[model samples]
Target chain A: MRQTREFANPPVVLGYATIAGPKEGEGPLAAYFDKVINNLYYYEDTWEKAEQKMFLEVAEMALQKASVKKEEVDFFLAGDLLNQIISANFAAKSLGIPFFGLYNACATFYEGLILGAMLIAGGFAKKVLVGVSSHYATVERQYRNPTEQGVQKTPTSQWTVTGAAAVVLGDGEGKIKIPRVTVGKALDYDMFDPSDMGGAMVPAAFDTLLVHFKETGLVYDYYDLMLTGDLARFGQQILVKLLQENNINFGQRLNDCGIMIYRPEQQVNAGGSGTACSALVTAGYVFNELSQGKIHKFLGIGTGALLSQVTTQQGMAIPVIAHAVAFESY
Target chain B: MAIDKNEYQKTVEKIKPRPPVLKNCVLAFLMGGFVCFLGEVLFHFLRGYGLSEKDSYTVVSVVFILISAVLTGTGIYDDLVRIFGAGLIVPITGFANSMVSPALEHKQEGLVLGVGAKLFTVAGPVVIYGILSSLIVAIILRGLGKL
Candidate 1:
């Protein structure tokens, strides 16, 4: 090892992620809605609160696993899909730690972690906590009408997840080391559709990931897993087809976080969106595997669509951005 | 699974739109009114903090801006907007709230280049028109020697 003071030998992933709502097969929320005359009137409302709760719970879980108290953490960095970070604010109020709230729409998970690692590596802080939260209801209310009920989702629509995930970082913990980060340029197709955020963001994702590969002189085969947040089957197909056209084959390692989160039996017409979709899956599924040392290198990419209701109302097109962070167990 | 003509017509008849329910109207009124009440309460609290009415309004504006900026930066505002829908945004505060957020969001792109220039994104048109109208009004008043 070069120096314990500089970097952890293995860069251990000490923490995990969590979700508040029951899995589709478990039937908790759907059952509650069924009891209310098969109406899901409060799903959004309930999901919003539960989403924040899960973020905090997940953060606590990770902190506990790392054996670090809330006070010992140097900074709390997080983001969400809400206009004013309601979940993060409430969570921070309870955690009572210094925090820097960030937003990159859906891409915030990677953005938060990358910034957290940067702060740690730069000696701004020894131990940094990075996390993000998302809810289904909170998103619909912001982008659509409040009083409208039971609007059928389009095939392109991705179901939002009510969850959050946090990861703790320090000087040397013998876990995964965050190696590199690539920032993407924002690309707006002027297409106002919100149901297909992945389509809007694919260009940015391709651009950034390709640029990272080129600049670092790395090949697509170098990373074992390359993932994108919220892009479901259709979007993933699009990403794959596009990359293949570009002669950049990501192989089977390329996957979408949204597609992985949904169970086939759930009848989720498309897949999942929302900040939590990426956060929890990465925390629960991806991090779980990472901790087991099954995967050594991963490139986590998050996509965010920059669409405000006012912009849509004013007939402005939705622009999207994507960011990526590379990770490896040293 | 082709349907008979008569059955298709009957199904279409059954799918006819119904009138708005009294309960829906009542729920909308109560929820919308409650949000207004909260706004008024916040305004009054700010007023009680020893500021003039105009100053309080400005303070409210600043508070709303900072709140949205911080929330947008932290990724919380998106959740609030998602759940509350227009319930939180349709009020007067929504306009200014939307304006400052994107500015703060792109601050890292370049504070001088991004934040300063893009801060007026949502409110830019309103501010420009407001100044133009005020200038026209002032010119009219001066021509009439009413200053």
Candidate 2:
């Protein structure tokens, strides 16, 4: 038997990471570990440095938990939502580990994990870490206008998640396993509704879910949970309806991390978007739940839309796509 | 590929020099001012249409963007932006200009995948955050008895 468990060497995901805007009340450096991270790191000369410092802090947290030196790790996999992956690239440069740059818009976490787990499972490396970071100001300027002033948005817009996160993956003691990974099928709606990306991703989510069910020869109840990335209230309901319409009732088990992470009414209209939205939730909430044996098998779905005004100016419409991965606790 | 200096010089000489004192400057200033004044008037007019001042500004931005996008597509706004830089960029016009430029720049990508998709590139994050955070913050306040 393959010893079907929750995760193969279920890397007990320890350590949480984040970098918040002024609205997050305090900077990441001001967290409880300020003395170790140093608040002055925020006073660095450039935003790029600031973001890299944030990632390093998160990575160090995972390293501390693992009780392993940075050099002991075989490779480092990181990414961000910048044009050149500056933070991740720089973090890799500073950390002096082999690097892999990733960009899936906000779906970077799942993508990073999928790659990281593959590397470890294929015996390419023993221990590895995967993470993604995004800042509101950095991503906003790249995708939109500068934040020197407030701008208006359409109903389809999604709030960007203002944080960074890192998680450790290893066959350490008391850890879980990560054996089977069913890469998700992508659904691109081309809806052009930035505010409502969840709606755009619904078709893809359903497609991936149904395909997973079909291929695995598993029914709706096969997994204990199904989670979607950043599909706040509006998108969540639309996804539920779409799935139910296809006779795949997700039931209460289908929880959206974007909707669930932040408390209600902070004005994350539809919910948060960014690579960290799902990554952090996966680390903080899902990992906790899975480790506690509260849930064995789960599905994670991340969605992103493929459209920008520059593309639109060329007479293009939005084509939204969603990628979903299924995980089982061994 | 080396440049032909003589041909380039001839081309440069063929280009007519712009007026030392801008005639278009005065016209752009007057027209841009008139448009902005109309926006203020429309702001109040929209209030009469059952919109709050905030809502009116929102409507104004949308209208301004629509008109500006059309004008930009026709290459008129670029002229206006050059002539009356700050004048055109103020209030709703400036906002509209910001919204349209990115779309125009990226229009070469295609409709479903490019133009339609990226219309929000400049404005998408704001709308996304505005809508999402509004809900999240509202819920938080309600939970805390602040709302």
**Candidate 1 chain A least-lDDT 10 residues:** A32-41
TM-score per candidate, in order?
0.63, 0.63
Give model 1's docking category: incorrect
Per-candidate DockQ vs. reference: 0.02, 0.02
Q: Which candidate wins on lDDT?
A: 1
Report the lDDT of model 2 for residue A167: 67
Residues A1-330 of candidate 2 have per-residue lDDT tens digits of 121112345443434444444433232222322122233236765455666777777778667765767887777888887877788887788777777888776677877777777676666877777768776656665677543322434444566765567766665554345544545544444455444566655555555556556665677787788888876666677667656545667689898877765555554556667776776667656666677788888788766555565775675545644555555455
Segments in model 2 whose C-alpha atoms lie over 4 Å from true places: A1-41, A44-46, A185-187, A306-309, A319-321, A326-330, B1-147
Mind giving the per-residue lDDT tens digits that candidate 1 earns over B1-147? 112335423432343223334544455456446656765677899889877888877766666656555666665655554445454455544565566565654455588877787667667987899899999999999999997
- Candidate 2: CAPRI quality band: incorrect
Task: Give i-RMS (Å) per prediction.
Answer: 13.9, 20.7
Displacement of residue B136 (Cα, Å) in model 2 is 49
